[model samples]
Target: MYLRRKPIFFLFLLLHPVFINAQFFADRLKSFMSTAAVSAVQYPKEVKEFYELNSYRFSWLEKQNAEQLALLSDYIRSSPSLGLSAGDYHPEIFPIAAIHENDSLLTEISFTDAAIHFLHDLMMGNKAEPLSYDGLKYVPACYNAAALLNVYLSPGRFANLLTDLEPKEAGYLAVKTKLNAWLKITSAEKYEDVAVAVSKTLRGNKNGLTRLYQLGFVASDTASLSEPALKAALKEAQKMFSLLSDGELRSTTVQALNVPLATRIAELKNTLNTLRWLHCVKQERHVALVNIPSATLLLYEHGKLVIESRIIVGKKSTPTPTLSSTITEVILYPYWNVPYKIATRELLPAIKRNTGYINANNYQVLNSSGKVVDPYKVNWRSLSAGNFPYTIRQSTGCDNALGLVKLNFYNPFSVYLHDTPGKSLFGLDRRYFSHGCMRLEKAMELGRYVLTGNAVAIDTLTEKGCLKNQSPITVPATEKIPVFVLYHTAWIDGTGMLHFYEDVYNRFSPGRKP
Candidate 1:
């Protein structure tokens, strides 16, 4: 009985130092947290909660957790590929080589703080500040930082958890993959500016083909290629750049090519940030995604694109604003209720110049009582912008400025998607011609899509047309489709091809050139 007691006492002696060390660390951590210096921590709340949950255990200093710390450091260093700046996390301050016990405890707390920040930024996006013009309204996904660290701090879980926290959308992944690839390519290659010649053909130009090949626009840099092949490659490059795609190496194409790889990388980063901001749209079933920069509309039904159309957005002077809303009503042969500003500032001069202009353009002058008054009866020359007290409206017709269809959604900007009589403008490459409204090339088709089950109603509306005494047909959407007017200058298309557009609104850094 004495020998057995002796062995048990020795076992207790072996565990005593371990317990003492843990208690010492816990007390020191508590004292450190109580000090005002803890206020300097980037994520003080999350750090405190994390340490409290573990009873102030040294998470990063433990021998078994070294691999986890190393993995976290790698992630911090590589954050730029994820559209985050590594400097934000301050990886340099991490005590990777700390030899002192106090340094180790401080390192543990700092690691937890930085890890929480990185995880929060990774999940909820780094750009929390709102842009005045971006009109981003959706709330990002929320996460408990302390809870995440508690679950994912183990050796085997940390790396996988980092990957899992990243955005899983295909578009985002594609851009990330491209960003990494570009990082590697730009590191190895020194790309020189390709000179643009207004009169010379770039078909046999070695410098042009070399730059195009480097950009993945052309298959090869061989100058012996045929004119047609070179032209086709140039068109492909132009398409990717959102240029005219006329198969000519014009100044715009040269400008796009001359844009440095660093600028392209920055553009890609901006695109990644934008995509993360719009991550909520992935859950939406039916959506009308109007990319303002690309001047295109993509209608998605249950996450699959059903309709793609060219669109005319606002000109630079009156850029279309980014906003999110739902399509509620569709109108066929819609009346153009000219805004007071347009009436007094734009059309009033025309009315004054020729009283017959109003009748020729199918415009109706409405008095304060909502009665259509004759434009000829009013003394047009006598009315100035400030004195104008009437409304001007274009009657419903094929020739109406609103064209044949209008999709209305409630917004403070009073902007809506509509058809335009100026169909020829849609054929142009740069379709920025509207006055802050979106002009859809397939407005009638969009109306049909919105009123899917009401085919008879669509047919009846089409037959009615712009006939006199017939009011415009109005149909409410059965299932309201969410519309997101976004401004993304860079994006990956459905074909997995990367494309860049001119920053039409000059919203981003390095504003659009003349």
Candidate 2:
């Protein structure tokens, strides 16, 4: 009797759509969250939260869900067009997994996993290994795991969310488009060699000129005057690379041109990663960004750049730390509270050479109690750097290295942006000459901007100097402006022109391909 009924019961279960779909969803969830699959990665918590939020339902199982999943898969596969790798997000295992009526559960799980990983990479970058620099303070795009799951699982919003995850900064997008165009055009061609034309006009390969034209550095000069036009093209290309516009296609220029497309793509990826951090941050009406690699500070008001000035960053040895902080105050005629490293390595030697160097440089030596010690009476030879306990303070005067102003920010690095009397350094295109602090070319203008966020304060400060003819005046900001000290080797400008700077500190190590 049991055997006779078993066949009919099995047929009933097979015919029931609800029962079949339920089993499919369960199988998909189990395969997706399998310990062997997700145990090694970072998304277990996120995956768990995702499934729990939907009560273990298959996210991409239904027809409507599958349609959205298809769109997402296409986007993931086209990552290379954006200078990213689809493989970086494990698209093979899930996001682009083929969905069928049978094993639809596994396919749905795979697709959901792929979407999560893709979003994570888009928002946080695909860098798996730890970077060497701890100085970078990256505030990653934050999201609640369950909330993100709900959005990605939602049929109406999932596609839009994928679109929104991309970095929308004009410069970043311009580079992305430029890279895509380059890849598209060069897809069929072999990498060609650029001939060196150092100290002379280019004679070999008008192909170089064509390359430059394609790269958007040269305007159309149809008149067949090769030397002058090519020279102009070289100069423009040099300028784009942040080199002196000498108008000669030297070995360096050739080398820069010959940098493999792979290198540029990697650089674009790095820039994209950095841009993600900026995109995730709270957009402030007024802010200052110190791009370390460019060695420039850009001041923005209402998201428009008000001014840009050359800056001196830390040397490669003592690199400037990347961080996000707020500028709360500006000090005019600021004192240079010398760091211990400087006191030992720099000042100690100067004092040993000439005891008078202390007074001549307007530096005062003080004990821990703040009592000034006469430099002449102190035994300079006996004071070793490690054993030294006194603080070296430079007075507010013409010779002071801190110059006329200092923009103070809150950070553990104890570094601030300040003025330098050695303005000649600004003329040099490569300006990585400071200790750890940033030396601003337009310190007075920046100080005023921080204080008042406009030109009024700058005019008053320039005309009358600080209040009451004071040696030092501390001006508090009415609203603290957000400051980001970042390092980006490649970026685009307002005119959609790409700019590449030398990696002074070698912050980006092109590890294994993404």
Top-scoring candidate (TM-score)? 1
TM-score of each: 0.80, 0.76
In order, the Cα lDDT scores of the candidates are 0.75, 0.68
Clashes of 2: 2
Clash totals for all candidate models: 0, 2
Alpha-carbon error at 120 in model 2, in Å?
Answer: 4.4
Q: Candidate 2: misplaced stretches above 4 Å? A: 1-59, 64-66, 94-103, 123-138, 142-165, 192-199, 206-225, 285-287, 300-307, 326-329, 381-389, 410-413, 448-482, 493-496, 507-514
Summarize candidate 2's per-residue lDDT along 17-52 as a digit string, tens digits: 433466566656666676565554446677777777
**Which residue pairs in candidate 2 collide?**
28-105, 94-110
Number of clashing residue pairs, candidate 1: 0
Residue pairs in clash, model 1: none
Poorest lDDT segment (10 consecutive residues) of candidate 1? 1-10
Off by over 4 Å in 1: 1-39, 43-58, 92-106, 128-136, 142-149, 189-206, 217-233, 244-247, 300-306, 325-333, 421-424, 444-469, 472-482, 494-496, 506-514
